[model samples]
Structures are given as C-alpha cells and as structure tokens.
Target chain A: MTIEDLIEEFDDLGDWADQCEVLIDMGRDLSNMSDNLKTEDTKVHGCQSNVWMVAEVKSEPLRIELTADSDAMLVRGLLSVVLMVYSNRSPQEILETDVRDIFSRLGLDRHLSPARKNGLSGMVTRVRAIAAEAVGLQS
Target chain B: MTTDMSQRPPFDVEAVRGDFPILNRPLESGRHRKGKPPAFLDSGASAQKPQCVIDREREVEEQFFANAYRGVYYFGARVDEELEATRSGIAKFIGAESTDEIIFTSGTTMSLNLVARAWGGKFLEPGDEVLITEMEHHANIVPWQMACAERGATLRWLPLTEDRRLDMSRLDEFLTPKTKMLAVTSMSNVLGTINAISELARRAHDVGSLICVDAAQSVPHRMTDASGQHNEVEPVDFLAFSGHKLYGPTGVGVLYGRRDLLCEMNPFLGGGHMISQVYRDHSTWADPPAKFEAGTLPIVQAIALGAAVEYVSGLGLDRIHAHESQLLGYAHEQLATISGLTIYGPDLEHKGAICSFTIDGAAAEDLANLLDIRGVFVRHGHHCAMPLHEVLGVQASVRASFGVYNSCSDIDRLVDGLQFALERLIVAEK
Candidate 1:
C-alpha cells in the first residue's frame, strides 16, 4: 500500500489495537532480509528490540528501498509504519519526507511510550541516513 | 488486588500514600491534563516526593532565601543550620560515623563521578586495575572508565550468574592487589537482586583494595549499614545514593566515604566554598564536605531530602522492606500466571521492590506504553545497564518498581494492563 493509503487505513482503524494489527500484518507481508545482509554495518542500534534494516539503491530512476525486521512483534509493527513511509521511494523523496510529522499524524507520538518514541526516532534516523547516503543528500 | 498482602504489619501504606501528594495525579495528554489515578511504578528511576518534603522545600526557599555558610545574616544562618542538619540526618540515615563523611553532589551519577575522578584519578596509576560488574548502571561504569583512561589504569569486569546475581565464585582472582578498587551496586535496579555488600566489602578489604558501593537502588528500600553490621563485616569505604531516589527532590545526592579518605582526596570541582585559601595560581581546600561541595549547594533539595529521611525513618526500613517484599511476591505470583511472561530476578526475601520482565512476543516499550495508557506508568528499556541486559539475553525489559506509596492494587492494575497489551501485541506465531 502507498504511504498515504496506509495512513488512511490507520485512521480508519479507530482503536490502538486495530492500528497495531495492521503493523504486524504489514510485517508479516514484508519479505525476510537474508542474515548475510544483517551485518554489523547494517544493524541499527538504540532500538528496544533487535532490529536490522538494510537499504538498496538502484539507478533506473535513482530509487532507494529499505527492508527491515525486529525480534519483537510490536517493533515489527512499528517498523511496518516506518517502511510504509520510506520503502521503495526515491532517495530524494525519502530524504524530503517528514517522518516526525507522520508519527504525530498517526498519533504514535502521544500513544507510544518515551522509550518506543525514542526507538522509532532512531529508526527514522537510520532510514534517513541511508537515503541521504544513496543520493548524497544532507540529512 | 490481594487484601492479605496490603494489610501487612509495620507498614501503614495508606498513611504512607497520604504523605505523597503527587500520587494518583492527573494524566497529561494532547494539551489537556485529564484525570487518572497515578499508578506510578517508575520509582526505579525517580520517586514521588512526599508532601512534607515538598512543603519543607518551599518553606526553606521562600523564607531562608540566602546562600549558605557565607552570609552573617539570620537568613543565611538558617540556611546553613538546616543544610547541615540535613547533612547529619543523611549521615545517620546511611549509618555513617559522622557528617564529614557525607559529600553532597548533584545525584548518584555525580556522586559516582566524584568517586572516580576525585578519588580514582588521584590514587590510580599505570597498570592498576578497577573492577566493576555487568550490572552497574552507566553512572557507575563510565566515570571509572574515564578515570582509567586518564591515569593509565585498566578496568576488569565481574560477570552475572544465571540467577541474575553477581557471580562471587571467582572473588580471589577478581580482587587482586593490583585491583585498587571495585565498584558495585548494592542492589540491581533491573533485576531487583540485593547483593551482599558487607561480604563483598570484607573480601575486597582482605585483598587490600577498597570497594565503593552504589547504594542508589538499595538505600531507598532498606537500612544501609555503613557502620558496624551483622557477621562482624566492616562497612565499605564509600557509598553513593540519590536524593530523588529516596523521595526527595532532585539535584542532591550523598557520597559517604571514610573520614580519612575524604581528607586525603583532591576536590572534583574547583571553585568557591570548597577552598580554605586561594592564591593566584594555586589553592588549598577546606575540610571534608565543603571541600567537595565546590559550588552553591542545592540547599532546599538537600533539606527536603532530610525531611525524606525523617519520613522513611518514621516508617522504619524493616516495615517498608516487608510491605514491598509482600507486594513484590504478589506481583511475581500474578505476573507468573501469564504463560509467556519472563521475570528476570531471583525469588528472594531480600530482593528490592522491582520487577523487570518481558513477554515472549511483545516489545518492552510497547508493553510499557500499553500500561501507560491505562495510567500505570513503568520504566522500559535497558535501564542504563545495557551489558546486564545483554547478559540476560534481551535488548530491553519493562520494569515496575514500588515505593512506600505503592499498593497491591497498583500491581493488580499492572497485570490487567499487561493482559490487555498482550491481547493485541502477541501474534499467533507466539
């Protein structure tokens, strides 16, 4: 689903549980990244759960796609939200996207605990860094 | 909620709850502070201040309103009197021999930093070793590391046993003479393990190395015996704990060191109030305490901490410990009912009022968030002990810590919230 479509879906799901179900469902749909690709170079720290995210840059239209996994169901659910925003997007678009605004719009900022908010912030940092790396954009 | 545990002896929890005005406070959300009974379970981090402590602070600040130890005026005199009274009170609270032994700092972190920088930096040399455990909070670990790097000293580690207690089996090897010092927590904040500091202190003493106990987790819950104790075990040379952790205000902490050690050490921070006399390029420090308290003291916070001492002392540590242990047992009993929940501490009588746990299929942060929405606030994450968590084989965990104000009903609410969070967070794959 497009990021906007997923945001709409989250809005439709009035309850926190329903929104979380969508996150886990998205995680179930996300392709498993190989362990070889989950090296120290790709592992993102500061997550409350073990999360490994990797970015692929392609030159056809200068696109960057990200795939990630987490040890905890809730984190995977949260990652799905992150992936919906940045995955398979152009490097320019990914770099330009305001994930904080997205998190606020989703009400995750108010709903999530401080620790989760920080971990999600870290995930956003890692993703933006990857996109910025691909197109040499300033973060 | 279990009525049996709540009605325990020596602790009147309802009365204790009355002391803290902030308990069951309104919840703040989305620009509006709404209503919710504060199920504050994060005393593992910082505690709710007692109403008496708050009143005392306001009174001191509003009435005294003067810099201490300098002004010959009545206001300054009152500030000095109250601050020193708090100093002595803290000394008595921790079983210190004298008030000179108590060095006030910003918090546990700053107290430890003083121990590392002022003491370790002065004494440690090349090839000297400092030993600490995996259970140490970053406050205890990082300062010594900084000292080791600066003075060419090396650092060693003590591992955690399977039951989450410190592994003391290899004490002889770890406490070698080259090991000039050992820093250890008196209790594990995350695991809730009550360490035998006296036994550890005696061992370190036998090996000719002093030990510094981080009693930040212990002092708030139990009686600290820095004086004579059971088993004929001598007190450690130094102990540090925070005011905030003990139901006092923040920005005040106590570092109790042996009198001689304080006299011998260089000051951590160099400024006014700590010096005896100052030259253009050199300065000599005053005696213990003032020698260490270089800047304007956190007068009101420290005085309120004295009131906190009074409050805790009035309840009695044994009673508080008993009440908490009973509540902890009830929580352990209840949380154990959930099949996939993993509690991380050993079941022991002396354990602190803390439970750090994780569910098989849920994130610690999410679980804490779920509880938070229900107005049951808890701490989640590595709890500043990433290595201890690494040893436990988890990235983070949810911690529910208790204070004198907490009741069995709080634990009940917590379990219900956890079950609710689990309903959605756990997939069938679990």
Candidate 2:
C-alpha cells in the first residue's frame, strides 16, 4: 500500500494496541539496510535508539534510493514510512516534498513519544539533507 | 532447591506509597481493581520524590532562596545556617568523618568528574595506573579515562566475570604498586551484583592506593553508612550518589572525600566561592567542602536532598533493604517461570532489587514500550554502562529496579506485560 493509504489504516485502528501491532508489523516487513552502509556518517544522532539511514544516488531517471534501519522496532516502522514516501523519488521531488506536513497529517508527531518524535524528525531531516546534498552534487 | 525465605517487611509499604504522591498518579490504563499502584521499576535512573522532599524544595524556593554564604540578611543567613546542618546530616548519612569531607556537586556525574579532575589531575604521575571495573557506569569510567589522558597515567580494568561479578583472581595484578587509584561501583546498575567494597577498599589501602565507591545505586536501595552498623561496609576514600536517586530533586549530588585528601587536593573549578582570599596575581583556596562547592549552590535541591535523606532514615535503611530483598526474591521466582528470559546479575542472593533481562526474541526497547502502555515503567538501553553490556555480549537490556515503595505485585505486572509483548509482538508474527 502507499504511505498515505497505510496512514489512513493507522487512523482507522481504534486501539493503541492495534496501532502498535500495525507498526510492529510494518517493522517486520521492512527491508534490512546492508551492514556496510550502517557507518558513522549515516548514523542519526539525538535518538535514544540507534538509527542509520543512507541514500544511494540513482542515475538516468535521477530517483533517490533511500535505505534506513533502527535497532528499535518502532523506529524501524517509522523508517519504513520514510522509505515509502522519499525513496525512489527524484532528488528534486524528494527535496520539494514536505515530509513534516505528511507526518502531521498522519498525526505521527503527536502520537509518538518525545524521544521517538525526536528520532523520527532526526531520520526525516537526515534524509532531506542527503537529498539536498545529492541534488547539489549533480549540479 | 528454592526455599520460602520471604519475611514480612517491618514498615507499611502502603503508608510509604502514600508519602510519594506520584505513585498515586492515574496511569494511562488507570488503577487496578485489586488496587495495584503504578509500577515504577526504574529507580536506578531516578526515583519518585516523596511529599516531604517536594515540600522542602518548595519551602526553600518560596521562602528561603537567597544566595548562600554572601548575605548578612535574615533569609540568606538562615539558609546558610540550615545548609550547614544539612551538610552534617549528609556526612553522618554516609558515615563520613566530618562535614569537611562532603562536597556537593551537580550530580553523580559531576561528583565523579570533580574527583577525576581534581584528585587524579593533581596526583596521577607518568605510568601510574588508575584501575576501574568492567561493570562501572560511564560516569565512573569516562572521567578517569580523561584524567589518565591528561596525566599520562595508564587506565586498567578488572574484568567482569561470566558469573556477573568482578573477577578478583587477578586483584593483585590489577592493583599493583603502580596503581594510584581504584574506582569501583558499590553495585552494578545493570547486573545488580553487589561488589565487596570494604575488602576492595582495604586491599587498595594496603597497596597504598585509594578507592572511590560509586554509591549512586546503593545509597537509594540500602544503608550506605560505611560503619559496621546494618549491613554496612567500611567507607572508602571517596563516595558519590545523586540526591534525585535518593527521592530528592535533581541538581544536587554529594561527594564524600577523606578530609586530609580533600584539603591537599587542588580546587577543580577556579571561582569566587572556592577561594579564601583573592589577590590580583593569585588566590588561596577555601576549606575542603567549600573549596569544591564553587559558585551559587543548588540550595532548593540540597534542602530537598536533606529531607529525602531524613525520610529514608525515618523509614530505616535496614527495613528498606529487607523489604526490597523480599520483593526481589519473589520477582526472581516469577521471572524464572518465563521461557527464554535471561536475567543479568548474580543469582538473587548477592544482588540488589534490579532485574536486567532480555527475552528470547523480543528487543529491550520494544518490551519497554509495551510495558509503558501497561503502566509498568522500566529502563531500556545501555543504562550508561555500554561497556558492561558489551561484556555481556548484548547490545541492550531492560532494567526493572525497585525502590522502597515497590511491591511484589509490581513484579507480577512486569512479568505479565512481558508475556503480552511476547505473545503479541514477537510470537504472533510467527
């Protein structure tokens, strides 16, 4: 399903337990980021959990390839949402996309704990920064 | 092989619970039909403040907050006068020789840093070894590493054994004549293994080296007076604990040092209050405790800490220790029933009421989140003891450390929550 569609599914889930289960489910299905890419530069700080995100430059169509991983299940689920939205998008498109607005629309910013919120924002910010850098390097 | 060794606690835990208003706070799941209180199992990080401590802090802030030691005014002078009394109480609490030995710092971290910088910086010569254990929290480890770097001293560590206690077989090897100091935790925050502090302290002294006990965990859970009174051990040269962990407010920590050593040490931070007399070119330092306590003190928190210590004393440390031991024993029995659950630390007998565990397929962070939703608070991650976790060969673990207010039912809730997390998150997927 698309990212927006999954968020709607999250909104439909009435109980906290159900939402948590869905998030954990998302985590279980997440494609593991290769260990080689999980290096110091790719590591996201300010997370209570360790999270690493890396973006590979795609040629021709100029789509940005993003991969992320977290030691925490909830953080991994959040990373999945970022992967659904930002991955395989053109560098310009990824930069233009308001990820924070998307997160607000999904009510993720309010739902997650302060620590998790910080982690989510850190992941999103790092991805956006990489996208911006990737676009800059091409020019 | 297990025996029913549990005895009834002397004091009323329910009455103790009433003193902590935070325990009565309505959890997200609300209170139980059986009247179970909120399971606060993370006292190793910080404890819930009692009403007395809260009131004392408010009283200090609302009525008697003025810059201490500088004012001749009624409020400021009164605060200073009261603080001196509090200093004596703190000294007696840890069984220090005098109030001259007790130095207040920001917290355990700041206190350890003070010792490492002031004492280690001044005394540590080239090729001198500063020894610490594998189980020490980063607060106790990192500062010494920095000190060793500054002073050209080598850092050595006594390895934590597979059995979760320190390997003392090479005690002589680790504590050589070159060893200038030994920094050890009174209890491991993760493993909960109580170290043989007095023996180690005596050993260190015999070798002509000093020892510093990181009493941050032990001070809250049990009696810390180094005198041979209730489950007491001989006091070491330096001891440190945070006020917040002892049911007081944050921003206050006590560091107890030997009077002679403190007098001889150079002042860590060069500031106004730490100086006795200031000259344009140089300044002579103040007396030991004041020499260390530079700048405006955390007056409110310090007063709250005094109240906290009094509250604990009122409860009686021996009684508290016994009660927690009973709960911890019961918790061990309950946890043993769970499959694929591995707990860190020595078997129940030698440890505090801390249970650091990881389930077979469940991640520590995931289990903690699930437990949080169920109103069972626990600490997850390295718990500032990453080196210890590395030694255990695990990335992280969930720690449920009990305080005086914790009950047997709290452990039940934790175990039940772990089961729910396992069934729903880990097993359901399969």
Candidate 3:
C-alpha cells in the first residue's frame, strides 16, 4: 500500500490500543533482514531501542531503496512508515520531501514519545545523508 | 513472602497519594481510559514532589525569593537561613557529624563529579586504583573513569554474581592496597540490589581506602546513616544523593564529606562564593561547603528540599520502607505468574522497591509504551546502567519502581498492562 493509504489507516484507528495494534501488525510485515545488514555502521544512536538501517542506490531510476529493522515492535512499525515514504525515491526527491509533517499528520508525533520521535528523525536524517552521498557520487 | 498489612501500623497510602498532585490527575495521553489516575512506577528515576514541597517552592518564589548569601537584606537572610536549615536537616537525616559535611551541588551526578575531581585529583597517584561496581549507574562510573585517566590511576570493578548481586567473595581480590577509593552504590538503580554498605565500608577502611557512596537510590528508600551514628555501618568518607529522587526539587543534591577530607581537598569549581580572598594571581578558598559550592546555588529548589526532608521525616522512613517492601513483594508475586517474564536482581530480602524485568519476546520500549497507554508510567531501557544491563544479559528492561504514594492497585494495573502488551505484541509475532 502507498504511504497515504497507511496514513489513512492510522487515522481510522480509534485509540492508542488500535493504533498500537495496527503498528505492530505493520512491523510484522517488515521485509526480512539479514544479521550482516544489522552492523554498527547502520545502527542509529541516541535511540532507546536498537534500530539498524541500510540504503541501496539503484542506478536504473537513480532511486534509494531503504531497508531497516528494530528490536522494538513500535520502532519497526515506525521504520516501515519511514521506508514507505523515502524508499524508491530520487536523491533530490528524498531531500525535498516533508516527512516530519507527514508523521505529524499521521498523529505518530502525538502518539510516539519525544525519545522515539528523535529515533524517527534520526532514520530520516540517515536516509537523507545516503541520498546526499549518492548525489555527490553522481556529480 | 509478603507481610500481613494488618499486623503493622496502617500506612495510609490513599492519604499519601492525595499529597502528590500528579497522582490525582489523569494521563495527558488520554489513550484508553479517560479518567484513570496515572500509576507512577518510575520513582527510581525521580520521585514526584509532594504538595508541601511544591508549596515551599512557590513560597520562596512569591514571598521571599533572593540569591542565597548575596545580601544582608531580609529576603537574602531568610534564604540563607532556609538553606542552612536544609543543610542541618539533611545532615541529621543521614546521621552526619555536622552540617559542615553537607555540600550542595546541582544533582547526584555533580556531587559524584566533585568528589572525583576535588578528592581524586589531589590524592590519586600513579599505580593507584579506584574500585567501583558493574551495577553502578553511569553517573557513578564515568566520573571515576575520567578521574583515573586524569590522575594516572587505574579503574577497577567489583563484578556482580550470576544473580546480579555483588560478588562479595571477590572483595579481597578487587579492594587492594593500591585501591585509593572504593566508590559503590548503596543500591542498584536497575537490579534494586541493596549492597552491604557497612561491610564494604569496613573492608575499604581496613585497606586504608576512602569509601564513597552513591546513595541516590538508597537515601529515599531506606534509612542512611552516613556517619555510622546509631548504626553498625562504618563511617563513609564521602556520600552523594539527589534531592529530586527524595521527592524534593531538581537542580539540588547533597555531597557529604568527612570534615578532614573536605578541608584537605582542593576546591572543585573556582568562582564567586567558594573563595574567601581573591588576588590578581591567586586566591584563598573558603571552608568545606563554600569551597565546593562555587556558583549561585539553586536557592528556591534547595529551600523546597528542606520541606521534602520534613515531609518524609514526618511520615517516618521505617513506615515508608515497610509499605514499599510489601508492594515490592506483591509485585514479585504477581509478575512471576506471567509466562515469559523474568525479574532481574537478588531475592526480595536484598532488594529495595525497584523491580526490573524483561519478557521473552516483548521489547522493553514497546512494553513501556503499552503500559503508558494504560496510564501506568514505568521506566525502560538500560536505566543508565549499561554495564549492569550487559551483566544481566539484556540490552534493555522495564523497571517498575515504587514510592510512598504507590499501592497494590498500581501493581495490579502494571500487571494488567503487561498482559495486554504481551497479548498484542507477542501474539502478532506468531
């Protein structure tokens, strides 16, 4: 499903319990991650939960494909949302997108804690950094 | 293992709960229950301020707020007297020899750092060692590491046993002649393991090493006799505790030092009030406390801390300890019934009010968030003790620490929240 569809799904959820249930379900559907990808380089710092992310630069469309995982179910769900927004996007597109507003619109900002919000932002920054690097390499 | 509440003097937890305004309010999240009172179980992090403490703070701000020791005006004199009153109260509370022993700092972290820099900086020599423990919070561990590095001394650790208790058997091996200091926590913030401070203090003294205590966790939960007055515990050279953890205000903590040691140690921070005479090139320092307290103190917060001490003292520490002990036992009894739950630390006998645990599949963060949804507040993650978490064989764990305001009902809500989290998260895994 598209990121907008996921946002709509979150909006339709009743309370925190419903939101949490749907989020954990999204986490369950996360792409299978290898132990090798879960390295120190991919690890997100200043997070209460362990989160690892990787970005692969695709030459065909010049898009960045993001894959990530977290030991925390909520963080995994957050990763899913993050990947859905930034993955398969051009470096310029990735840089220009307003994902923080998108997260706030989805009510994830209100639902997730300040600490978790920091982790989410950290993921976004990592993806942007990779895309920026790709732009550098292309230049 | 829980005591019969009927046999003991009735601890009116409901009345106590009324004193903490936060306990009466609904959760700000407004998630599941609309009007459920927040079950605050993270007092180990920082206790909720009592109404008296809050009032005391407001009184200072509204009535007679002034920079402490700055002026001879009525407000300034009143502020100084208030601060000195707190110093005397705290000195008495911890069974210290004199109010001169009490040196106020920003918090426990600063108190510890002062001891490390002022004491260790002057005293530590090459080949000397500072022995700490694996279960110490980062606040207790990092300062010593910095001190040892700067002073050319070695930092050693007293390891925890398989059950997370300190390895008392290895005491001789760790505490050597070279051990200039034995910095230990009175109680583990994560494991809730109450160490035998008296024994450790005695042994450290036997080896001619000064014993410093991180009493942040213990001072609130149990009676602390820092000077060994009316207690079997040996007099510790240095002791540190935060006011916030004792149901006071933030931005204030106490560092108790032996009179002789405080006199001998160099000033930690060189600034306005800490010195007696200033010269163009060099300056003479003030006595013990003023020497350590270099800057303008947390005047309002420190005054309110005096109220916090009075509040707790009026209630009696023994009663609070007994009440929390019952709650801890009840929590253990209930949590054990959960299929995959594993509580860390020693048995009920050796623990304080903290209960840190992890489920087989549930992440600590996820569980804590779920608990929050149910209006149950708990602390998660390594609890600022990464080495202890490493020793406990987990990256993170959920901690439910009790205070005087907590009751058995809070534990019930915690269990219910945990079960709900388990059903939602663990079931989704399959």
Listed per candidate, the RMSD to the true structure in angstroms reads 4.1, 3.6, 2.4
Candidate closest to the true structure, highest TM-score = 3
Let me know the TM-score candidate 1 reaches against the reference structure. 0.90
In the order shown, the candidates' DockQ scores are 0.31, 0.42, 0.79
Error of 2 at A124 (Å): 2.5
TM-score of each: 0.90, 0.94, 0.97
Q: How many angstroms is the interface RMSD of candidate 1?
A: 4.8
Q: Candidate 1 on B1-430: residue-level lDDT in tens?
A: 1134445455778888877777845765532223767788999899999888999999987887798898989999888998899999888878888889998899999989999999997999999999999889999999999999999999998987778788889777787989899999999999999988988988888888989999999998988878644325578898999999999999999899899998998788998899999999889999998899998988888889999999988777778888888899899999999879999987757578999999886788678766765778898889999888889998899999999899999999899889877776664445
In angstroms, give how far residue B1 of model 1 lies from its true place: 34
Give candidate 2 misplaced runs (Cα > 4 Å).
Answer: A133-139, B1-9, B28-37, B227-233
lDDT of 2 by residue, B1-430 (tens): 1123345346788899899998997754422223345789999899999999999988888887898889999999989987888898888787877788888898999999999999998999999999999999999999999999999999999987778898888798899989999999999999899998888988898888989889999998766765434345555888999999999899999999888889998898888699999999999999989999889989888877899989988777778888999999998899989999999999877899799998887788889888876778899999999999889999899999999899988899999988888887678777
B262: Cα error in model 2, Å: 0.7
lDDT of 3 by residue, B326-368 (tens): 9999999999999999999999999999999999989999999
- How well does chain B match by TM-score in each candidate? 0.95, 0.95, 0.97
Model 1 off-target regions past 4 Å?
A: A5-29, A59-61, A112-139, B1-10, B26-35, B229-233, B427-430
Winner on lDDT (2 vs 3): 3
